[model samples]
Target chain A: MPQLERLWNEFKDKGLHIFHVESQGTSEDDLKKFCRAKGMTFPQVMGQGSFSGYEGGSGIPYAFVIGADGKVIWQGREGYHAVITEEMAKVRFPGLGKGSVAKGLEKAAATFAQKNYGKAMADAQKKLEAEKGKSSADAAVVADAEHIIARATAVGERLQKKAENAKAEREYAIAMATYKILEDGFKGQPFGDNAATALDAMKADKEISKEVKALQQLDAMLAQLEKAAADEKKKNLKAFAEKFKGLKAAEKADQMAANL
Target chain B: MRRLGATVLSAAFLFAAPVLMAQADLKGKDAPDFKVGSTINEAQALSLDECRGDVVLIKYWGVN
Candidate 1:
């Protein structure tokens, strides 16, 4: 809050416009209360009603810095952060702090590739914090966070795949969660196009890829046995028999029955 | 009643506090409008629409 206040104070003379986008649910009341509390002298919209145009293709807190000709000088993070601010910083300031934030994030990504998670996270977090009214910092943080997770997960899956112990469904779930976070976080940014791309990849849920199908089949068989054991332990013998009979792998079913 | 009065007074002050500072000039274009609770001599809302005819200096002073 102090950071936000300082930003407003510092940039007031620079024709900086701050628009708060409101949506339905818990965040709605928060916006109203924030408006009242912040003494926002500028225009704010209720967002749900006639204020939709201000929302652009996305929703609230998504700011745009427009040039005098009505062209979007900066569109907030469609890929990673607030779209308008990101676009604006690159277009307007070019080589300002926002640019540095972008460069720092790129460097951090390189560092992460070298197995320096601590340094990467620190560098990314610092850039995110120092990123003033500029949207680049926000985009950098979002991208870096997702990049770190995605890279780490990919490496884990790669090692597991090489060892013939990969769990396809587990990989899918992790990827899905990563994409979901990115999707939610990029709401007001101009990075909508990139977000859509990432979302599509996540939604693919490629569990049946040829390289993973065997592992998935084995995992399914193991899971069935585990469930049977759990049911048996719970004294649900009838359910356990039903589950054991339903096993798709005949070998696993026979093995389980032989054990029983 | 006291709580209600305090709430109203606080809201009024919050609403008026920024206005007390020099507002950015809104000379032309649509003047933005904002509303607050009841206050003495306070317009029900502040709108750039009201300052339409003259040199409406609309100043944007805040984070972008």
Candidate 2:
């Protein structure tokens, strides 16, 4: 884990991304604690959707690396370290890199890179207005500021679409998270307002609210499953499935019990 | 996609083959997009294409 953390620190500026996919219902608190203790900074999330074409090997720490071209470049348990090193060297981000940012726009660019789109847009907008019609140096700031605005706007729209798709698919948790980001993160934006309206309408739906409650309760129940002994956890899961009967939550619980 | 431990992996041959098959089947193809079932630290879900044109590593792991 520390090695992975080191890799992240070394290559994050070079555009490397590492994410931990935990399928076994480890509580967010526990996962955060574990990562903190290990000094990990990369995103760690629970698994979803048959891993979208990748296989979950029967191992604790196996990994798969996708190249900048979005192809599976390397995959294995611990052997990935050196391979990642090699793959990292091959990356060449077009028109963007750590050193490409204009000095005047660096701060805003940093915020944008951190995914703080709201703050990034605000800061960049200020720079854009100030630098507009100024000298050649100012033109650099103006260009980067416009780039930030364009990227952030695109991301906002994409998230809005993602939330709608999640809502249609009945994946309420994901829909809510995406909407909350749009609503809170993009506060003054039109997309944010739309997301807020969509979220309110969804929450008002009786069927959606009922299912959301079931999934939340199921998440709460699974938290305890992480600590119990093997046999006890199985028994508890069976009971859980029955408890959630007739709801989609039951199917998820049933899958866990069967896995056990 | 089911359980997250070696015990579950060995217990179910059903999962093992598919994982190996996927490794063989999907190599070099545009990586299939993974979903955020839930986030452990992030505020929102991310689509794989969100990081398009950058190296992304998915480390599939378990607490136990």
Name the candidate that leads on TM-score.
2
Clashing pairs in 2: none
TM-score of each: 0.22, 0.52
Q: What would the per-residue lDDT of candidate 1 be over residues A204-250, giving only the tens digit for each residue?
A: 64532432343355456555556465445334333343544433333
Tell me how far the alpha carbon of residue B32 in candidate 1 is from the true structure, in angstroms, after superposition: 16
- Measured by DockQ, the strongest candidate is 2
Candidate 2's C-alpha runs over 4 A off are A1-16, A19-100, A113-115, A129-132, A135-139, A229-235, B1-64
- The TM-score obtained by model 2 is 0.52
Q: Write the per-residue lDDT of candidate 2 for residues A53-129, one digit (tens) a residue.
A: 66655555767888767788777777888877887766553212222456677777667666667777898888888
Tell me how each candidate scores on DockQ against the true complex: 0.03, 0.29
Give interface RMSD, every candidate, in order.
14.8, 4.2
